[model samples]
Structure formats: structure tokens, C-alpha cells
Target: MKIIVNAEQRDVSGCTLAKALEELDFISTAIATALNGCFVPREQHAETTLSEGDRLEVLAPMQGG
Candidate 1:
């Protein structure tokens, strides 16, 4: 399926958010995720299903501010 990840179009095979993240090589635990402009908690990642054309945003904490 085709979805938008951090504003970039990506093709993913996983149907769940967690699996997609794994396929995308996003193994870091220190990150935040949002699906289609809605915040998705860490625990829900495994259950959250993704559809084609969905917008996924992955953000990691940054320092130096």
C-alpha cells in the first residue's frame, strides 16, 4: 500500500502501524507517531491499522533548544 510518511510517499506491506515501522526500519523507542493528523500512543501502535493514502508522521525528540 502507498502511504505518506513524514510527508514522503512510501510503499509498505505491513497493515499495522507497528509492522510498518519495523519495515521502515524505525526501531527507535524514543519517538512519537501520528496517523492522519491524530496522535497515536505507543501502546496502540500494534493495533492501529493503516490504509492506503494514509498520512503517517514519525517524530523523534531533539535537543539543543
Candidate 2:
């Protein structure tokens, strides 16, 4: 499926958020995610489904102030 990830177009095979993250090599990283402008809790990542044209934002915490 095609989805906009962090403003870039990406082709992912996983339909669920957790699977997508694993495909994108972000499974073990500490990051926050928002789907289609809505915040998605960490606990729900495994159940959150993704669709084509969906906007996904993956944000990682910065060390600097």
C-alpha cells in the first residue's frame, strides 16, 4: 500500500502500524507516532490499521533542548 510517511511516499506491505514499523526498521526505536493528524498511543500501535494515502508521522525525541 502507498502511504505518506513523514511527508515522503513509501510503499509498505504491512497493513497494521506495528507491522509497518517493523518493515520500516523502526520497531525497536523509541518514537511517537500520529496517524492522519491524530495521536496514536504506543499500546495501540499493534492494532492500529493503516490505509492508502494515510499520513503517518513518526517523531523521535531529541536530546538537545
Name the best candidate (by TM-score): 1
Q: How well does each candidate superpose onto the true structure, as a TM-score?
A: 0.96, 0.92
lDDT of 2 by residue, 1-65 (tens): 99999999999999999999889888755899999999999899989999999999999988976
Report how far off residue 37 is in candidate 2 (Å).
0.3
- Local accuracy of candidate 1 as per-residue lDDT tens digits, 1-65: 99999999999999999999999998999989999999999999999999999999999998996
Please give the TM-score that candidate 1 achieves against the real structure: 0.96
Candidate 2: C-alpha lDDT:
0.93
Candidate 1 lDDT score relative to the true structure: 0.97
Q: How high is the lDDT of residue 56 in model 2?
A: 94
